[model samples]
Target chain A: MSLVLRETALAFRRAPLLSALSVTTIAFSLFVFGLFGLVAVNIQRAIGNVAERVEVVAYLKRGTPLQAVALAAADIEAFPEVESVQHVTEQEALARARRDLREFQDIFQDLETNPLPASLDVRLRPAFRDVQRAAAVAERLAALAIVDDVRYGREWVEKLDRLRNIAGAVGTVVGAAFALVAIIIIGTTIRMAVLHRSREIAIMRLVGATDGFIRRPFLLEGILKGLLGGVLAVGLSYGGYALIDAYLLRASFFTAAQATLGVAAGGFIGLVGSLVSVGRHLRST
Target chain B: MIKFTGVTKEYLKTGAALKQVSFHIARGQFAFLTGHSGAGKTTALRLIYLAERPTAGEVRVSGFSTARAGPREIPRLRRRLGIVFQDFQLLEDRTAEENVAFALEVTGARHTTIRPRVMRVLTQVGLAGKANQYPRELSGGEQQRVAIARARVNDPVVLLADEPTGNLDERATRGIFQLLKDINASGTAVLMATHDLDLVRSMDAHLIELQQGEVVYDSAEDAAGRQPVAP
Candidate 1:
């Protein structure tokens, strides 16, 4: 173990330029991947905010009893997907309309009787905010005897669902492509490091060093380089995020857990890349 | 002890490197493997070290046979034998002492014993005073001495030298040959491969000469009147 550490340190000292080059290469590659991840996370969040507006509104018939309406509101709130059901009285609806649509406030004030209908506003749970779930809840609300009509933005909800699916598919496919590129580029970089030490490896073998012994130092070097690269990559990604968030529209960065996962992913990639690169060199020699 | 019985090595591109060759070296015996560059001297040494397995037949060295030596067994076998090359395969980044200590380290020798063992071999190779010098700072002969010290540090039963003096001038060559002789006097067997026929004539060591991958002469068989050679 001490020998392995000594050898790894010696290798870095022996070829600092090569080591730095490989680390920089890994960092840039991971930075690109991290940038894409940042974009995906922000897109998902934006879609989530939009999905919060997907609620079903059920307008009651004019003569519906307050007791019946109250009972119906309690039943709807009991549904598994229903987050909350608020009942707005006719006067409250008129007041809300006057507030929301100020251009029509004059006409609302001139009216002798309230022209608005009392309604139940149904907000679904986050997970149930998609088009199919909203439509299903609307169908149930329309079945109530007191509900004259129910509206849930069917076309708009369907369009949002399509956009969400497209974003998800693109995120997965593009993320995978970036990850593969990082592996190949990082693998080649590690291979160069192995090749640089080919003479030392051959001599180690001649001196009766086991294959496992020869591989340990290189593996440690790779992991260290990867870890450094990962940290640098995170720093670079943050710099990029800061630029965009400051100059452009508001954006979100990775959560702490997600950043840690990105760094761990870098280490994992480094380990795998070193394994393959050193394995080939050992096999060939 | 080392023995080769009908050992044949075939490469896909270069074809047969050794052809049905057979020989044996008793414990603590010195021998010479003489041949032209195209002959199988290096190939024979490689077989002994398990660098290349025989296409046919067997190579048995230090209780490990190539036929049965798995990946795990190869290192064990190699630890019992030391290998030297014409290029003096010392790590340029390491000092002479570190180079020698590397062998003992690989064998997982006691940490307390490593410094003494390395110093002993460096002294044996006449490089004790130069222990801290890097290979690049040392002359060709001194570099080769570091390589030999590294080879000898493990207390191997047999030392295989493939043109150990090939890169040295005549003076250095003679000095290295004498070093090997001194090492052999310490009871370790030596198998030296060389194209230097004059060096072979200077010694009464056991001789096995090869021509184009086949053994053309064996001094032991000739002395025993079992096989006759043209010259």
Candidate 2:
């Protein structure tokens, strides 16, 4: 262990510029990855919120009895996909219209009788938030005897769902690509370090040093670089998140668990990279 | 002790580097391997340290058959032997003391044991006061001494030197030869490979001469008035 430490210290001392460059490259790569993660998390959260608000509005027929309207609502609520049903009376619908369009309030006041039909607002469970599923539920509601028509923003919901899928796919692909690049960068850096100390390694081998003994110091160096890079990335991400949160009055995009996971991933990448580079060199020698 | 029996080394690119060469050095014995360039002198030493396996036959160093030693066993076998190079392959950035200590360090020696042993070897090589000097700062002879110190630091049962004086002046060569002789006096068997006939004749040590991967002459056998067939 002391030998590993000494060798690592000597390596850094021998090539400070190279070590710094490696660490910087790793930090920048991890920072970009973390930034993408933050964006993906925020986008997913926004999509979830939008999907939760999707509901089917079922209008009641004119002169429908109050008891019939309540029965229709109860039947809609019994659907497996339905989460809840809210009854909107004609008077309440008129009042909502008045609140939504105050400038058109004069037109509603001039009406002799309430022409607005009562409606049943049907909210589906989160699993049934797809455009096709909601449309199917709306069709079932529209068949009710007391229901006149059923409407849900199928086109808009489909578009939003597509957008969410695209975001998720792009996030995964780009994140994986970034991680692969980070591993390559780290492996190349460690390879350079090993090359720089090739003579030392040969001498060690001559003196009965096992492959593990010769490789430990370099592995430690790679891990240390990875750990520092992770810390830098985490710090930058946290600071950026704090800045965004402060300016936009929004909650953090990355959870504590995600931050920890990111750091762990960085360390793991460094270890794998080191192992690959060192193993190749050892095999060749 | 080191022994090679009908050892042959074949390289795909260059063919045989050593061919059916056989010899033996008893415990605490000192011998010289002398030959022209590409005469298998270095290859013979390499086989002793398990650097090259015999394409045929066997090599035994300190009672371990190098040809049969597994990967995990090779390092342990090497720990019982020390090797010196023609270029005096010292770590240029490290102090002489550190270079010597590195040998022990690789063997997982304790810190307290390593320090005194490193100092003792440096002193043995007459570099006690220059322990802290880097290879670049030291003279050619001092650097060579550092290499020797590193090799001797572990008190290996056998010391293999390949052209140890190839880059040294007459003064440095004599000093290094004397050091090797003194090291041998301390009971470590030494196998030194060189083409310096004058030094070999001067010392009159046991000589094994190779020619085109074949052993042409062995002094010990010659002293017994026996001639072995050369392949």
What CAPRI grade goes to candidate 2?
Answer: medium
How would you encode candidate 2's per-residue C-alpha lDDT over A138-176 as one tens digit per residue? 989888888899899889889988998899889889889
Per-candidate fnat, comma-separated = 0.83, 0.77
Error of 2 at A137 (Å): 5.5
DockQ, prediction 1: 0.83
**Against the native chain B, what TM-score does each candidate's chain B reach?**
0.96, 0.95
lDDT (tens digit, per residue) of candidate 1 on A112-182? 99989999999999999998899899999999999999999999999999999999999999999999999
- TM-score of candidate 1 on Cα atoms, chains taken together: 0.96
Clashing pairs in 2: none
The prediction achieving the highest TM-score against the true structure is 1
Per-candidate TM-score against the hidden true structure: 0.96, 0.88
| Candidate 1 Cα RMSD after full superposition onto the native fold (Å) | 2.3
Residue A187 miss distance in model 2 (angstroms)? 1.6
**Error in Å for residue B11 of model 1:** 2.5
- State the DockQ, from 0 to 1, for candidate 2: 0.74
